[model samples]
Target: MKYSIRNILNSRSKANGNFFMEITKILGHKPKNTSIYKKAFTHRSMNIKDSEGNAINYERLEFLGDAMLSAVIASHLYLEVPSGDEGYLTKMRSKVVSREHLNELGKELNLLSLVESKIPSGQFGENIHGNLFEALVGAIFLDRGYKHCEKFIYKRVIIPYVDIETLEGKVISYKSLLIEWCQKEKKTFDYNVYEDTGNDDVRHFSVKLSIDEKVVSKARATSKKKAEEKASKRAFFAFQNRISQFK
Candidate 1:
């Protein structure tokens, strides 16, 4: 007895019912291509390969989704804020699509619950949720095109969450503001970062923030960027009154 292609497809369809239901609940729409959704949730640790021998995982989709998200957000900001200059629009888009914000959005939706992976979710970092969210966006784009993807973003992101007036005052990075203030005030500022190769399980970086050639603040974190930013934030608070006058 030989099974037809239709029979194989039907079997797969039956197996994917639960996944489709979960996706529908999250997306507020039924997924057109279930395979795309599968790839969205597939972790690199699974090491699965497609018929073409290419790795089946979310990383590539995450990259595509990130670009798509930026484009959609930029377009929306452009149309809504007709008076906003390039810098203003760019900053607004950054606030909307920031990694921290994306992570929060993913967590709110409990996107991790749908992930298919060999590694335990507890072993994953906070960024995993954000990454998975991006992958899902990419899958949506591939399965339904830009218009549908935009609709999804607008419904899931823009409608309930975005408030332009509130976002204008929001500080995406206090460190960036501090650096700009230092530059404007003609005060020499530098971040001295060095690797902390100590006995700790996670490798870290230490940062010393120097203003006018004097050490003002210091911090340490798992990443050099984060350590430097933390040091800058500390320096900013110490000189808040002085810095506020610059702008």
Candidate 2:
């Protein structure tokens, strides 16, 4: 019995040591509170609870990190683009903190490798990467402070990816753009979505995007939103010349 306890303790000690080294490299500074960092990578499936019965996971931290990211990015935009109006600044910030962009950043950092969960890692969706990234930001905030959080964002997000010229031209959401264009042109549009009848093991959804009662594009994906986005992308290219002018 003593041997088993000792072995367990040794294993956890080793894991914590490795985690500290990895987190230090990522943060560019040693974490004062390592426990918070662990919570950041914890998956809800683990069902962990603290002494007061509060659930221990990354969800709450994700929320904090998201707000921090927005604040820092918004502040940078406000100072950098003095001529930008409210709408312009808001849109620019949205583009910078878009889900797709966050996912890309998370993937680049390989944050998924640090997650602790009861479920298989392969079963997790792509958004998990972004969630972990945000949780890390939250952990940094709690461990160090706002300044450290801002510094990390500048290193990971601003200095590397925030370019006004490129961001202005980037289309974060084709669906939003298509809808806006249709609204401006006073054209009616419809998206006929339904379950795909494919024989693949994974169920799928299909979308047919019609503009002005004429089918402009058809696409299929694992979810309704993805299928719609795919259709919207095809439709965007179809009406590229006109849409470019409208944009």
Q: Could you give the C-alpha RMSD of every candidate to the true structure, in order shown?
A: 12.1, 11.2
Which digits, one per residue and each the tens of the lDDT, describe model 1 over residues 66-125? 998999889888977999999999999999999997886787678898887899988999
Question: Clash number for every model?
Answer: 0, 0
Per-residue lDDT of candidate 2, residues 40-84 (tens digit): 988999787765667888999999999999999999999889999
lDDT of 1 at 205: 94
Error of 2 at 149 (Å): 0.7
Residue 103 Cα positional deviation in candidate 1, in Å, after optimal superposition: 0.5
lDDT, candidates in the order shown: 0.80, 0.84
> For residue 95, what is the lDDT in candidate 1?
91
Instruction: List where candidate 1 sits over 4 angstroms from the true fold.
Output: 1-15, 170-247
Question: Which ten residues in a row are the worst by lDDT in model 1?
Answer: 238-247
lDDT of model 2 at residue 3? 20
Query: What would the TM-scores of all predictions be?
Result: 0.64, 0.65
- Angstrom error of the Cα, residue 216, model 1: value is 45
